[model samples]
Target: MKRFTKFVFKALVGFLALSLGLVLLFKFVPVPVTATMVMDGNGITKNWESLSNIDRNMVRAVIAAEDGKFCSHDGFDREAIEKAIERNAQGGRIRGGSTISQQTAKNVFLWQGGGYFRKGLEAYFTVLIEQIWGKRRIMEVYLNVAETGIGTYGAEAGAQRYFNKSAASLTPTEAARMAAALPQPKERSVVNPGGWLRRHGNTIAARIGSVSRDGLDSCIYE
Candidate 1:
């Protein structure tokens, strides 16, 4: 028992140290790849762009479409999580309340899919990033590491693939279209969207103005 306890203690300490080192390293360094990117069977297409290089419209579009309270939340949104739980209890498609920070942590440090163990690790990494990466760095990494389209990762690749333009040149409508597709990059259509996808993109585009006017994207800019 004593020997087993000692082994567990050392293993726990080693894991913590390694996780911290990786988080700190990524705070300044561009992440080369992620578990999601590696697991993508379609092949990888990405071009790293600094946050400043990506259009502000893209940031506002994602904030409006995904997490309205992004600027105010730490790493998790308890109210959203509660709502998701309540909805899930009723039985239908499962919903998630992951904030941008949580998504970033999962995308960068963990693999896709959900189980209590994976979710726990996601929560752990989310806290680490919120503390070490800050809102701006979190947003930057999220934009870069997120799977934006089939076989494509990041805003740069997504924009070029969909609009034949650079991420820095995306307009509000274009950005919204990309943002709408982000939730289901493999299935959603960005180039010639219609039906629900088109409507959702329009709604996101309309909300982008409010995101800017209301300063919901203040954290990223500041």
Candidate 2:
């Protein structure tokens, strides 16, 4: 029992240290990943500062596609999580109802998997990301790393590759399509808006009037 307790304590300490290290590393390192979305028709690493305010379209689209309750919560949304749990329970593999913070945790630290162990780690990392990176930074990283196309990543890259525009200038429909393509970015086409894209686009458009960019300022990162 004592040995088990010791092991647990050490693991907790190690987790804390590792989490801090990740926060520092992502903050300083322009995380070097191939742009999923091509920028200027050329695939390259797109790195931008965290302070950059993204297009209202992009923000609204992301919210519409991902977490609708991002503005109302701290790090997690229990209701969405419950729905996800019920869905995943009915199905075999795990499905996520993660908010942006939780998604950032999985994207940054954990492997893309649906295992219970991975889910727990994702939660741990989510807490850490929420604590360290705050809301705006989380949003910034999410936009930049979110896969925009098959092998196309980052908002700048996605905008230029899909619509021949910059991230700042993406229209509501364009942004909505990009956000909608997130679940299967590599398999799905951001450049071509198919059925899901059109449906999600319309959904985002309706929410665009209410999704609050101003409220993001209150996020822990901001």
Best by TM-score: 1
CA RMSD, predictions in order: 0.7, 4.6
TM agreement with the true structure for every prediction? 0.99, 0.80
lDDT of 2 by residue, 1-222 (tens): 999999999999998897789777886566665222333254544545343546867876787678877766778999988988799889886677889888777766766657789888888877777777767678888887776675556788778788887788778888888888888776667666668667777787777666655453344334
Q: Specify the poorest-scoring 10-residue window by lDDT in model 1.
A: 213-222
How much lDDT does each candidate structure score?
Answer: 0.95, 0.72
For model 2, which pairs clash? 35-153, 36-151, 36-152, 36-153, 37-152, 37-153, 134-221, 135-221
Cα error of candidate 2 at position 199, Å: 2.0
Q: Tell me the tens digit of each residue's lDDT in model 1 across 67-167.
A: 99999998999999999999999999999999999999999999999999999999999999999989999999999989989999999999999999999
Give candidate 1 misplaced runs (Cα > 4 Å): none
The prediction achieving the highest lDDT against the true structure is 1
